[model samples]
Target: MRINVLQHTPNEGPGAIQSWSHDRHHEMYIYHPYQFGNLPTADETDMLIILGGPMSPNDDLPWIKQERVLIQQLLDHHKPIFGACFGGQQIAKTLGYQIGKAPHKEVGWAPVYRQTDAIPGIPEQVIALHWHEEMFAIPDQAQLLFSSDLVKNQGFLLGDNVIGLQFHFEPLADNVREMAVNDNTYPLDHNDLHQTPAEIIAHGVPAENKQVMYTLLDYIANH
Candidate 1:
């Protein structure tokens, strides 16, 4: 499978998704819009994976708009899209959802209440890494797949081709460290729901938890 990853920062790489791609021996092409000005053309992309970033999708920048155009084209083609955090906001914007600033920043590991309508492999509740301050409204075409007590919209499924997650299931402990190094978000108790870096790492990345992430990616690979 040919996958195109839209990365906005040097710190945020594909992480576990890269591992999954390597494990499957799938072809991956990444485009960094933050560094170079060009976003990848979705022509040969079987699936598009939008990674997390610190930038807001609502930013009025040429590159951001350019990315949106690509997103629209991919949506029209019914190509699969898996987006996290900022990527999720971009997906929601392209889908006509209002992206708003979250009252509190959710930075740490948190549990999401899985909806009964969730796809296979997503348990009733799962603790996933989160780091974001923006929330997107659920598009009418999409169904809410997961919700947390703090954030109502955690994940949504819009057709089999598109899925958006507000948290980072792609990041593990090492990935978290990388992000921490890039951003001065340490001292950990950034907010009430925020956990310290040590706490998050202590929990570690569970194999089963990552398998659930792979399950979602598998859907895009096969379906």
Candidate 2:
């Protein structure tokens, strides 16, 4: 399968997702619309993985709108799509759902409770990385997948081919470090939910986190 990634920033590239694709021997490509204004059409892409960024899906940038159009095209084609953070918000916005401010700017390792087994293989509860101030609202037709204390809508599964997550399950230790170094004000403000760079990196991407990510990828691939 030709799995294309939509990367909004260099630091937020596909980490575990890339590994999963490689292990599966599926072709994967990353596109940077923020830097190169390039994106793959639905016809050329068998599956699409959208990564997160600091930007909002509600931004007024031309590429933001263009990305939404491409998302719609992929939806029309019934292509599998997995979106993380801002990428998740893009999918929500494209589906006419509201993207609003989260109660808190969750930015560390936190436990997310699974709401349903609709997408099987994920545990009932698992600790995942969080780093977003805005959250996506679950569409009426989509199944609520997960939830956290800071964000009620942690993830959602739209139909059988689309999944959106509010947390970071794809970043590895190096990717986490890159996120901290690249963003000057990474933590934004230290709080109960937000942890220091050291604290966040110390945990790294746990084995279970990587397993759950691979589980999701396998589910998407098989479907």
Whose lDDT is greatest here? 2
Report model 2's TM-score to 2 decimal places. 0.96
Model 2: per-residue Cα lDDT over 1-223, one tens digit each: 9999999988888999999999999999899999999999888899999999999988899999999999999999888899999999999999999999888888888999999888778898999989888999999999999999877899998888899999989998899888877763767575448588777777777779888999888887787
User: Model 2, residue 209: what's the lDDT?
Assistant: 85
Worst 10 residues of 1 by lDDT: 183-192
lDDT of 1 by residue, 116-181 (tens): 454776778888877887898999988898888788898898888788989888876788787766
Query: What would the TM-score be for candidate 1 when compared with the true structure?
Result: 0.93
**TM-scores of the models, in the order given:** 0.93, 0.96
Query: Model 1, 163: alpha-carbon shift in Å?
Result: 0.6
Pairs clashing within candidate 2: none
As for candidate 1, its clashing pairs are none
